[model samples]
Target: MSTDTSARWRLRAHAALGALVAALPAWASAAPRFADYPVPAIYQGRAAQPLLADAHSRNYATRLRDAATEKPDFAGRYVLATWGCGASCTMSAAIDAKTGTVTWLPFTVCCWDADVEDHLEYKLNSRLLIVHGARNEQGGGTHYYQFNGKRFAEIRTPPRHAPHPPGDHQ
Candidate 1:
């Protein structure tokens, strides 16, 4: 190609690249960030420990501890502990910060799904824990649970709509 044609092509490529870079931040901002959730001071300096001394996770050796963002009125901070159960499964537990007791959450979530974005989320201002995904071909749905100071109890409410996973029928 001639020098002028090559220059024009380079200019067009540069313009396209600039447009892509400008749009990237907008796309990234729409996703959730770790800082968006509240973390208690206790979880900040402590290292992750075994979820339970006797309990076994599928393959992982330790459970990473995080502060439960909701229900601040409850005494000490309740910890949200999570670990990989297997290649596709993730297990979560609730650890009582004061008592050092761990309560295993009921469901095992899919770490990777081709059809939908499967994950767990805690509501900001309540004791509600939502598990979002398709479980054993039941179709995608959000399962709700309320932490009643002792254990997480599944609530019989309708599923709320979330952006990432489509076709939630429950």
Candidate 2:
């Protein structure tokens, strides 16, 4: 195609995509938020022993068990245990405080350049989790997920934050 024709075609495609995105339902396009998925209530029961049935959980049993002994730090009744696998690499699992079941985050996060103390962001009374860094060294960016008592479901349309200025890694 000629240069001018290609330019017009590209513009039309961009417009079409924008229109389609604007038509999506609020829940489909809106970012996943902690407040939106609040825990039913704060957990008051005693923390259960960490169960290590899955291969991943079994591999990290010691760490998982130790972390699970602490009070719930995620999703009201779950302890989100995180540990470093290597430099700048982190692996995480969620241990149910009410039950003893363990759930892994599917992939280890690494290859990030941020200056934060940790890459995982979560709260005790919220089901939302935000991971800062790459999942399995794929690409570096912020990722969001929501825990639904069993496993985490990643949110693909989380809001984007402006990039830090050059030379400022904080």
Candidate 3:
């Protein structure tokens, strides 16, 4: 009778463990492929500038690479600062080596400010895709543009936040 009870507990434990493992979110390596990029051979516009492609497409990825290059073993991490625009404004995006889809991480509130200027920094992920169009202060008007391994879409941003303190915490 005791042996039978032990066996049942063990079986239940195993099932619970399996369920927990299945519920976990996938890691960057396991992230789903967002889109299929174009071949560089058919790339249009400016010549294939490998570094530029990564730098201009994403912000965080570019910062990580620059830090890593300047100082060995630079950590690929960043903080996002979203400037508040009164309904309808453009947002810049950035990608990382492990990032599948480019996420917009605006480094600066305004696009004009060079020091805190918001420029899209690109990095080599598996493939590259660009999302253009403005996002309202609340949320609306989202668009997407695709880039091969090279070439980036030109986007203009309206004045969203002031460049005084820098952080867009308002």
Best candidate, lDDT: 2
Please report, as a residue range, the 10-residue window in candidate 2 with the lowest summed lDDT: 161-170
lDDT of each: 0.53, 0.79, 0.32
Off by over 4 Å in 2: 1-31, 157-170
Query: What lDDT would candidate 2 get against the real structure?
Result: 0.79
Clashing residue pairs in candidate 2 (N, C-alpha, C atoms within 3 angstroms): none
Off by over 4 Å in 1: 1-54, 57-61, 64-76, 111-118, 123-125, 135-139, 157-170
- lDDT by residue (13-50, candidate 2, tens digit) is 99999988877854364445667768898888998998
Residue 160 of model 2 has an lDDT of: 43
Tens digit per residue, CA lDDT, model 3, 1-170: 69999999999999999887777533212221222332323212222111334554444444434332221110122111223343324444332232223445432222233353332222232233222233333322222233432234423222333123232211
lDDT by residue for model 1 over 13-105, one digit each (tens)?
999999999998666534332233333443232323324544353233334233333232221345666666577667776765554455667
What TM-score quantifies how close candidate 2 is to the native fold? 0.73
Best-matching candidate per TM-score: 2
**How far does residue 38 in candidate 3 sit from its true spot (Å)?**
12
Q: Which order, best to worst by lDDT?
A: 2, 1, 3
